[model samples]
Target chain A: MENLDEKFNETIKMGLEIVKETEEDRLMTLSVGPQHPGSGHFRFTIKVDGDYIVYCDPDPGYVHRGEEKMCEYRNYIQNIPHLERPVIHDSTNITYSYSLAVEELTNIQVPLRGQYIRALASELNRQVYTLYWLGIYGIFLGHSTMFMWPLGDRELFIDLLEALTGARVTHAFNIPGGVRNDMPEGFKDRCLRQVAYFEKRLVEYEDIFYNNPLFRQRTEGVGILTKEDAIKLGVTGSVLRASGIPFDVRKAEPYDIYNEIDFKVQYMKTGDSFARSMVPFLDMRESCQIIRTLLDKMPQSGEVRAKLQPNPKGPAGESYKRVESGRGALGYYIVSDGTPKPYRVKLSVGSFRNILALPYLLIGSKLADMPSIYWSLNYWPVEADR
Target chain B: MSSNQSNTQNGSEQKEKVSESVQTSLSKKTETITLEFESSIVNHLVTRFTDKVVQVVYVRPGRTKILVPPNEIVQVATFLKDTLKFDHAESVSGTDYPKDNQIEVIYHLSSYSDEKLSSHVLALSTRVDRNDSRMPTLIDVFKSTEYHERETFEMLGVYFEGHPRNERFLLPEDWADIPPLRKEFRIKGR
Candidate 1:
């Protein structure tokens, strides 16, 4: 009778301990949501112990539009406008890859002058995209001035793109055969002048943003992605370059006169948020030189667009083409079944690959460093979700 | 500059023509194709997976396609990652071949550490049973392939075995329609 009574008391004590553990919570869950300022069209659930984040789960796809599925419905050329919408700010480069893929499937060749012009617009769009990314990165880390300057400076390129392509953001300039049109009359002199002034503006950016002690303290050593971790996780663009890899798709797989144009691949070994931010800055400087060279070396006059059938189709085959966009290597895989519409169109975006590094980089880091680490990966939520 | 050669399947000839024209106009630099050396990496892969690979073709410049049986994909991927040092997967793409009643999953693997391998993109593909579409995941061999496998899971409904998280990523939680990327999943009002 005494033993039975003791067993009952022990069971009650165990129940009480379970209740106590539930009442005294150690980790707090925070849902950085779809509408949050720091998180862009995406949500992530992070478990925090005080200020330190213990766990993180990135919830992407708030903007999934079934782009691959939709590609089947539209003919090849008609899909350009919708495809570019994923990363509309970096529209040219995204369309550049698509055009290259479509060209491969349909066996269309982009002219020498057309290739140079395409590369020029791509470089210009890179500047626009990077500047916009820098602005958002700045605001994410609570620096108002850094945010304002890049946004204002971005207009210089946007104005140039508007003149060259007519549309500011969604240029729809890249087509399967070649670019839609050639460089506008007297575009060279204006582009050069603005590019030179932009070089001076870059110095101002370095002075205010890169060298700022407060910004450095928050980003310099925080969120360090080692060389091995970076390659293993397959982070691309600035994130991979920041981790000390000199694998730029432009130099690695030169397409559309990238090999002909001379420029150094900008990379850094530090692999921190600061390094991630600085590589794009250095790339902007390199892009200015590339633009000048492209202008100087471009053919005097030639055909820009190759004439194609109303509905271009080719033999059954598959082709994949990649371009070095503002964010790493953006690739398009096209499968043609001798039809006007594609059998399949798979867009392998850099934003999607780069965003995979989040959970690895975010865990065990301070909650305050979340925005700094997240934005440093150069992940565009809309592109990634697509 | 406009030539009938432009519409040929392998546009390398046109690319060369364009390169030559650029050189002639500039009269400053020599235009040379740097991909000659990178093709050897594909040669090495062929030698390694001779019996395993059902077909191997240089689909285009800097792009190689290797087709293998679904059962042998993991083995071939291990050889590429460990021996050939194709460090990371660039992309995982799926093509639904309804006529054949199979789903082709292609893993585009490349390297950042090895300069030669870095320049080459190897498209390793295998066709799995459409009705019972399942294949072993390569996440263990290449960490970068985790999310891509998850994407293939929801998009084409290819079940990647051994993947930790195979839940819906881009689709809604309550979505029960057939995977949208399949050949027959037609968009409404098209």
Candidate 2:
């Protein structure tokens, strides 16, 4: 009886606390958005001293779909497509990598051909995501032309994805053993077209965004994180690489067809928004090369999903898998107890890593620069809140 | 970086590249392959290493898990930074191994050098006295431990000893009850 009351009291307290806001001295407490174009699906309570943010408390949970807990409740095989929902743009990469690791743990094998296809699809998605990030960062800095270019051009690949996977955003193609949909007919030509098309656009992107003085003024030296500080803050993905650490999991520890592909690990030493800008740009170029290589050199025929007696949950065990997402290195730590559902599931979301360091970084910067800094780092609120 | 290759007695020229161990600039490391390393032997090996004072403990297998006591964590982390030179903490994760009545804080550390690709993960583990749940703050050693530790404190209710600020890092301040991260903290009734 005492325990029940104690638990009940605790719940009520938590319920109230979630609604509470900071009482920072405010000339006017400006609410950024629940639907503002600046924020995707979240709100920020900023105490503004004229044009500068005196204090910024991010009001998350607007997009909290309970992604982590939902993963726990879902079955082993059911979780394949679900985990990718937060960052639907990078669906194949995160889902495929996670399924691969989980399959590895339960002693399932995805066939060599499947591995190559998975790699191919992931690389393709990486290019699309990079362009989207660049576009978002462009608009964040007030350049609409930069935003429209990539968003418009991104369709060609989306078409390629639709033809192959039957869905543009939710490419639940990856199954436990292998992909649900195999490469369709004429995919090679269409894929090659976009791949070649991107080859030309890659330089144009450099000319328009990277070389543009205005973009540099907004991005370059904006979020300068030193090598030591980058490590300290636990920043991952492009943010870490932008600090000039060539730590790409694909290169460091190869998974799928990464070992066979020959490509350079791209990084920028400046550790600023400009440096952050270069990551997706260079990455997209490298991905284009990888897609071409994988397509040209892929084996004629082999199995896709590994042969496993049963895809049922393995004995009580745990597995941690980190794969490069559009934002950074996304890790999924899953624990099982010989049951249908997971005993625990914790998503080490990529954007959340960059999001947590905001108060420290945004403390003294001008309020106007917040949007640029946010977009340049490429934080997806749904992914972060997940 | 020096690579140590042991000669194959039967040289069929099959070409299997095997190294006994590779040198990673001032530190010699052999891949553990999987997460499972015998705790007692690893402890013995830690004592044998010269130049650097560090300890590696296996927390769990199949998962990249490790465990380290607070006393050894500071020394080992310092050695990893100054001696072996792993300057980055990639992820700071917390686990409530309630069966063992212990909480594990895992720091995934890596080097900036290209030659050293495989991360040398060392687990820092301390079991809080269940009733008196407390462990010294690791924020002093690894600065990033502050946020992770606070999250752990909020979720698992594992008391952090001498934490610079025990204030909420993730959850709201006025929230009630102990953290909900403990493995045994059953949600059935709630």
Among these predictions, the greatest DockQ belongs to: 1
Candidate 2: global Cα-lDDT? 0.67
Residue A386, model 2, lDDT? 65
* Tens-place lDDT digits, model 1, residues B96-179: 999999999999888998997676788999999999999999999999998899999999999998899988888888888999
i-RMSD per candidate, Å: 3.3, 5.3
Model 2, span B3-102: residue lDDT tens: 1122222221211111112111111232344322323223332433321323332233322233456556665667556655556555555566667766
Q: Cα lDDT for residue B97, model 2?
A: 67
Q: Output DockQ, candidate 2.
A: 0.21
TM-score of chain A, every prediction, order shown = 0.96, 0.88
**lDDT tens digits, residues A175-198, model 1?**
898888888889999999999999
Badly placed stretches (over 4 Å) of model 2 are A1-36, A42-62, A307-311, B1-45, B48-64, B70-72, B97-102, B113-120, B129-131, B164-190
